[model samples]
Target: MIKSQVGRRYSKAIFDIAEEKNQVKEIYEMLNSAMVLYRTDKEFKNFIRNPLIENEQKKAVLTEIFGKDSSENLNILLYILDKGRINCIKYIVAEYLKIYYRKNRILDVKATFTKELSEEQRTKLINKLSQKTGKEINLEVKVDKSILGGGIIKIGDKIIDGSIRRELDNWKKS
Candidate 1:
């Protein structure tokens, strides 16, 4: 993923500090809350995302919104966005979550399925995947009807495609 250097730098600095304080999870929650605010508040999102807005104005707006309760380190994060590096927020959050999980030795699994999975199905799959991969998986699920049937399971770089689309591709090849 192409991420702005500012995002990576800010994420790294916060990740490092959070790890040292054993507050990584808490920080992630805080960032997620901020992201939600950015999404839900029209004025807030526009102010941050508008190229016409001055960086100083954006920074001041962020401070007005979050400065008091936000950790000092977290303040730097808003600046990265103010400087027009906001596109990288998603990448930074994902990476920061990965780092947090890695420190806790968790495997973050992303499963794309044709249908919505049941709680029991998710539990069974998590158990099965844990045994196969020898890691505790934090599951992230996405439903894509285009898969037709079954799902694609991704754990880091490895992808296991059991989707019907792949089956059709193989049948065509044959």
Candidate 2:
């Protein structure tokens, strides 16, 4: 099977268990924390990916990292290690987060403007987006002076390009 398929399958299994136990948020937090470590800590990432390290050793290390009480998170880690699919941990976390966010009605959005938004502008934008999408918005803001003015909002696959650069381009075309 493909690597991503492995990720999807394992994530789905873990997510199903989390949903049944009403611990979806907790599991997501634990797994996401692990992913963050795997992403940012070079030593930890290498240790987990090293084939010479025994699975038992890896399990113990992961258990230590994730805490003994995090059974759901530890079980997923052990299972993945036992199956020698540790390389797909990143994809598993990514897929699991997709499931968790969808289940929780959360939307990840990115907004870019020429300058920083004032507190009122930020609040109003979030409120309007939440009302329009009916999902709690997780907004990430960026500043790009080249946009000149106005802003651009990106929600999932859709891009709302209201930047002044876009407007100027349209005028030039006309």
Candidate 3:
């Protein structure tokens, strides 16, 4: 909980700087890339979380990985490391993206279906969701065979379940 609070503060600071320099989009992409790397690369994740490794070494590795990116964003990475808040990088990035999406009036929606959705289906779903939510939709689709058929859509704390399994359960209850 405390870590998240700290992350929020750091993200807000970075967002403010990015917003001022008109580089919010670039910085967001950088942070998102970093977060993806951190999540997908076990060795890199362990390396960053290792306390035995010196801050300089971590900073060097970070520079090598994202050096070509914005200097301001790089400085923020260094600043967080210097402050011993490196462990909270994931939360910081997540919070930063939340701010970015909110600023742009984009709603992040997760949808699960029994099978893959084609381009037309995805577009129709996104358009329908956008209209329902009154915000631009950033859809993340996943396949869940357990759903049996149909799909489920989640936005924030609310979930709309349209799966055949759910329908069967409702029928049983009735």
Best by TM-score: 2
TM, every model: 0.73, 0.89, 0.88
Tens-digit lDDT track for model 3 on 114-155? Answer: 999999999999999888889999999999999899999999
Better model by TM-score, 2 or 3? Answer: 2
- Residue 165, model 3: lDDT of 98
Clashing pairs in 1: none
lDDT of 3 at 157: 97
Worst 10 residues of 3 by lDDT: 70-79
lDDT of each: 0.78, 0.87, 0.90
Best by lDDT: 3
Instruction: Judge candidate 2 against the unseen true structure and give its global Cα lDDT, from 0 to 1.
Output: 0.87
- Candidate 2 per-residue lDDT, tens place, 34-61, comes to 7788889999989988988887888889
RMSD of each: 3.3, 1.9, 1.9
Q: What is the lDDT ranking, best to worst?
A: 3, 2, 1
Give me the runs in candidate 1 sitting further than 4 Å from their true place. 1-5, 39-42, 49-60, 67-74, 78-87
